[model samples]
Target chain A: MSSNSKDKDNRRRRRSSSLMYQEPPESLEQQSDQAVLPNLNAQWVNAKGAWLIHIIIILLLKIVYDIVPSVTQETSWTLVNITYMFGSYLMFHWVRGIPFEFNAGAYDNLNMWEQIDNEDQYTPAKKFLLAVPICLFLVSTHYTHYDLAYFMINFLATLAVVVPKLPALHRMRLAFLNPEPQPTDQ
Target chain B: MNSSNIGTELPPTAVAFIESAAASFQKIPGSAIVIRYIRSSYQNDPIRSLVELFLFIFAVRYLLAPAYSTKKTKNVHLTEDEIDELVEDWTPEPLAGEQSEWEKLENDRIPVIIGPAAPKTKLQNGRTVTNLASYNHYNFASNPELTAKAVNTVRTYGVGPCSPPGFYGTQDVHMKSEADIAAHLGMPACIIYAQSFSTISSVIPAFSKRGDIIVADKAVNYPIRKGLQISRSTVRWYDHNDMEDLERVLAKVVKEGQGKPLTRRFIVTEGLFENTGDVVNLPKLVELKFKYKFRLILDETWSYGTMGRTGKGVTEHQHVDPNNVDMIIGGLAGCMSSGGGFCASTEEIVEHQRLSAAAYTFSAALPALLATTASETVTILQEEPSIIQNLRENIRAMRAQLDPRSDWVICTSSPENPVMLLVLKEQVVKDRGFSRQEQEFLLQDCVDECLANGVLITRLKSMPPALGSSPRDQEKEWLPRPALKVCVTTGLSKKETEKAGIVIRHAITAVMKGKKWQR
Candidate 1:
């Protein structure tokens, strides 16, 4: 087979695998009403990538502390982690994504996408605040010159996870909700 | 080695990166084989090993994100074209992700008849006092105690709560009604809504929301469907009264959400279905609830005052403990013969509804007089338990002697249920030579004929469209065939009950032959 055809086959396999959970609309409706295109899209497309990064970062730090005795500056890493958590929690939950509880039930007590819309007001401020704590930690700890090894290992690992999810995170469409469809390629 | 079917190869740099990553991932000590060897390694240093296991999981999820087997379901996100097709030719796709927006039920188009007489079926249809077609089974419209309470409340507080519940609209009588209903249901707390229409509609949304899972009966009422829509929760509708189907769905959902503790799951159903006048099997439901750890919400709007030994509803009637069910929502309109709705549950749940429920917060409170009447009705239910007993006996009398032939009229619901439904035979409906609308009109006309013959009966009125009903018998209609609902009241004597059965039987037969039986 031609290399080009093989590449197309590979792409087809990727699409089908990523979408293994999908059924025809009628079957999906029969199975679970909330398990529609919009939610599925929101789940994969707009998933909180920041949260994924945080977990990976924390795991790497813990490995450093456990395996190599983590040279020093423990307090700085802890504080930096704390701020990342706060910023991501607020932004993801309030604006970019929906928590399970808010989206999982028969009737929504929460107003329709009101919180998602309201997310715009203070997110930039919260993001800015997040940077301050990280900057302070770096300033206090003499951030560079310690170890490229740990950073390299964790960064490479996280990129593997984050790269594939990026498309979905950007393009997630909440199926039932009537938001205008946007082109995902951008 | 097997490069013959190779896809377009990546650039050399990308290939080199992939090779190096594979080598590095293999070299990382706990990252590769730790998961497979975890059980054996756990005994070496359980706590440290546990920590290692978690870290390993994190690393693997990150490393294999592309290959991660996520358990999300495939959904048919309709293309714009599919939406257009559905819009033009709306079909019976009950569980279709999007319920057709343009399809209208008979009740949506037809107006309800307003009855005037108390305890008697004297309906006011424009000019003359016609037979009251539907509602308030016992005609408590003229009960002395209820009337006195209404009169006193009107004299004191006037007609309505003009403002919403959060405003100055909450009356003392509303409190009493909530308390009375809570006590009657043997629940810790209760919250009353303005009217029956919004009762289930508001209550279901109060607890459930998007991302949650709700497994309800397919034949649930319209209000429940509306509530489901608002919550945007994942919902699965099991077939009506089919416990096995409910179990299959619950088991599958529990399996799918195996590790997801935060994703709430509930089993929602009606005690006596509004569409079919059938009772749900509560004992079996409680058993399934226990097995699947699903919170149960029983909407007993039709069964509240009519069922049970002392009128404690499905729990009393079915001999199941009430505490097993998490929430109970019902209307006061049934045997109580009042206007309004109440939800009874744990104190915490009721409190949440008070703070979170949109209908309660945003809508006017129940009228003070109506609340007083509801409270009085509860008191009467308890004090004169005979009210429920008499109703049951009347039901028994109606069910016993009224052995309707399959060809004539068949009682579809349980005999113990005070709400008796007499429906046209399926074969007959299919065989009939009329158009779908004409068939509906003829069935409705039979109800009118029954009313003219001194028995106040009504056709199955439209409810808020639930995953509502059955496929049409004759046409491409997506609704249950029209049935005559003869609500047997406690006030009916044995003779009256017999007369009702006779009248209904005669009506259906004569209506089929295209003849009208006069009073």
Candidate 2:
């Protein structure tokens, strides 16, 4: 009898909604990132001799292109410039999140560009990354003898990669070309 | 061998190969430019050329070096034979460390029951004594109806499920028991585990991960502390049962997390503190959980089947809605006379634990008999609220004889609590100048004295700190004060309970005043 009455009382009382207690949902990307340990994908860029490896890679690429049969010096420099810019752009900016699954999707919404130095703009690593391409373009143009076609190709490749690293476009995504995927419910 | 000697004694094939390599180097286009550039860059400075060579070598070495180990140990290279010798020489320490004299004595002194535990239990020594140590508060263990149902279940389903719930082990009896418990607690869903001791420990890590935050009471039970440790979450402790301190800690945590992305935050505490025999302020906890946007994980193991008018647990007793708490973990072993535990929560949480909780997923399911017995016990508690009233009356009778009449000790338990914890008076402890260990010894003496006088009681057992933790790590560990535990049961009449309580009080007085125990 008492339990029956107690059940009635419980039914009469309005069950309090917990929605009021929940915090207003913000960008889940940032929130999920904060929920995990620091990202390791971008951290290697700050390690010892990490910058030197990029120059080594470019030199290796130049040598490889130069050894191709019947390739002129101008064509080799142009090929090196385009290849380096394309690789760097794909590596540093195009890839979203980490390749490793250890972080539990902590960096899923963040590209390597945003993940570098914890998304801090103008870090030393970022500065060196930005300078490498411009210097490469200058060398490629000088080596190409400032021919209009070769100069144009080198300059455009440099511009394509350098604009994304600017602080103004830190987290910007080209929506039409690369639409953000819907967040999967875990 | 010197390089000059090797050059002078070079084989004809090697010389021909070198000559061909040089010829090919000269044949390559831009070879003239590369030589010219090198000559100009060298500019009669050998250091510049040497530095360039060193840079090339350093880059190669850096790329070829093995990945660094995450562990902080130095990389010590050893020959295979040396490693074999080291392996042969190694002797592992014993799994369990050496037991102290007190531990060995306590192990020997443990009373072995000859039959089913009850108000009057026969010990291995062939003596019948009034039992107060077992948590048979309502004495439902020997109920004829429950026993009959259990026997029926065993006859129908055998002794065990022989598999975890995920496989073919989830029997109909288990589902009925889960439904009964969920309905009794007024929660949306419930999930049961095979054992009570590891329930919360498994439930904690299932939801709270490494980077989450947990604010727990300092006096939580051993299982809860272990759960917090296993979760690896950031833990902050507040003073036991102090609502103000809990509020302050919550505010401090919220302040510290400002501008950072929000992580899952939880406030963990117990319904009735098993060590201190006191109840938590549930309304205050719920309010603070809302105020700070933290979820509440309330462990009601000790208070679930013992508190409230209809045995709905602390939420019912304190008039707080069950939905307010995110998770409620309760033991069926304590008062329900069953052999497992349950967590009452929403359907989502219950479904989650079915797949994720370690004990539930890996351990075998509860026996069919225990499941039916738990279901029967929940129904009995709801239908017969007078059983709770009888327990409270026994508690009152026990307290009347022990609390005010005893001059050497005083009861620390709340009035409604059946587990009466009698601690030495503050003044008596101060005058005697007894350390924690000495007080524990005195309490053990009191328990022995009570048993000698035909009353069976126990002491509040304090858990040792976890292994591998340094002494400095235990500086902030909290231990309950030494006290004699007298768990009042409805199995004994009010008069019998009063008589047993008097025996407990006199036993404490005798132990405290005895010349042998005097400092």
Candidate 3:
């Protein structure tokens, strides 16, 4: 009995060492669930007035910032550009999953950036989104009259958002900034 | 067309205004840069400039378009008089179509029980007849012990819950009942819904969303069919109780889904079929579920508290572990003679249903009295194994009287099923060449004849044509064979049950021999 038990243990060890470990079944199940339904997170970007809404938000931010006493056009423009960039980044890249629960956690592992167009690298929507920040930077720089301080700040804000959207960084998680989804109790 | 000629032809005020506009445009900042940019971009090509102008106009038109359009095609232009004439010519369909002749007859023939449903029930016609139509297989609805318990519960908790279970409607009794059922079925936990008919319907959509695959038996009861419709899940049907056909369908689904993402695949079936009154092969079903890695949602509404040795349901009867089944939906109103339904499964599944299942979360909790009665009945089933045996024995006696002895009809139910379903024999049907509607009419005649002979039974109730669906649409659906339902009960003595069974057999014979039914 002891020799048989040892033989069984050795076989188990050999099998474990021979094969490369694959992801847990849960991840595959989640992937299938994601495939079953179209991701709502990405589809909303294509909706009517979706592009217009971004322009409206930037305008609103400019107006609101301008209402503050003694604010200059340069300051207000830079603030609008920064605010829009931050909001877009939070909405598109930082959040990992949809706001709605109807899809059954299919998008839990993916952010809106990776979910758009089923993770295709460069669609029209993505291209339009990438152009928005760059245009805003140029607009802010022009309004600021190319002041070194404001131009640098606007450039940095644009870079912060545009860099993460590159296809190479798709589904890549930063260790300190964006950790993997913790296993839910369910 | 020359500038000098145009200037000379224009009025003095117009010419002066044009000159001022040009002067102001030239005065604007970065006007030279704008001209340079356009010149470089279009490269002085008139076609490119025209194209750009057209694109600009198109973008403006698109942006200005209305958000929602009702009609895809262009609207027809009609004169006012023509529109009035068309409006006058149109007629609206009726809200509900007139009931068919069969439906009217059925409505008129519904027997009104004046008192409690029992083995012997007094109908409005002032006749006490043997009642074999109710889901009171053990006749526990009128049991003194259960009645006392129900009364005690009512006194303590009142009649109405007044809230949904997710709210304050979940009383201590409800928890006790859930625990009792979970323990009785040897499952981890159980959740109870207010009504049995809507229980499975709600539980189905809770887990199985769109794109999820469901493999169901063709002969599942009406409630299950409704559940499948409401779930909107992809459904595949196999021949009823045919394991080979089920495996074939499962394998096909798996193959079709190959390399695609794994969906939540389910095998939805009943332990004892309510439509056909036959038992499912549970062991083989469990094997198939494991083999395919598909979860099993077993509706044990008819078999629970009727089939097992101590009435723990199909799992006990087949000696399969209850844990192997993903979800077990059972009716408390059926053989248990209480009200509501319970879904027993693992803790996680039950917890999920608490907030997800519509009938449980939206509807008021089951009344406290019914919960107490359900708890007590489950306990009685556990303590006294003979109640089930008594029911089985009565079933046997009923079978002996009707199944082998009847020449016109044959029992389609398994021997263990207390609800004995009698369908016209194949030879009888072939000889008469009866269609589905004719068979239903013949079964109704048998039920009426049995009632006149002081035996109360019912015909199998087929679902009404689904709302807004034509009879032609219903033709594609699988309809259970029209049959007479005779529910065996322990309330009656073996001799009495056998006598009623004989009366039923004679009733079928008499109906078949009647000149009105002759082919």
Candidate lDDT values, in order: 0.63, 0.82, 0.83
State the lDDT of candidate 3 residue by residue for B319-431, as single tens digits: 99999999999999988988999899999999999988889989999999999999999999999999899999999999999888888888999888998889989999999
**Candidate 2 per-residue lDDT over residues B1-519, each given as its tens digit:** 235855676777888898898899999999988777666645454654564455345434434444322213477999999999999999999999998888887787778888898889998898899999989999987688878888898999999999999998999999999999999999999999999988999899888864578999999999998888666567889999999999999999899777555778999999988888889999999999999999999999989988899988899999999999999999998889998999999999999999888899999999999999999889999999999999999999999898899888888888888888888899889998997878988888888889899889998884667788777667657878888888889999999999998888888888888997786
Off by over 4 Å in 1: A1-186, B1-115, B119-132, B259-262, B397-407, B430-438, B451-454, B463-478, B515-519
lDDT of 1 by residue, A108-167 (tens): 222222122221222332232233333333232233222444334333333333332332
Prediction 1 global C-alpha lDDT: 0.63
Candidate 3 — which pairs collide? none
User: Which lDDT value does model 3 have at B175?
Assistant: 98
Cα displacement (Å) at residue B242, model 3: 1.1
TM-score of 1: 0.64
lDDT of each residue in B404-462, candidate 1, tens digit only: 54365677778667777766666665665555556667767676566666556667765
Q: Candidate 3 at residue B327, lDDT?
A: 97
| Displacement of the residue A1 alpha carbon in candidate 2, Å | 60
Residue B27's lDDT within candidate 1 is 88
Query: Stretches of candidate 3 above 4 Å error?
Result: A1-99, A102-131, A137-186, B1-93
Worst 10 residues of 2 chain B by lDDT: B62-71
Candidate 2: give its CA RMSD in angstroms: 14.5
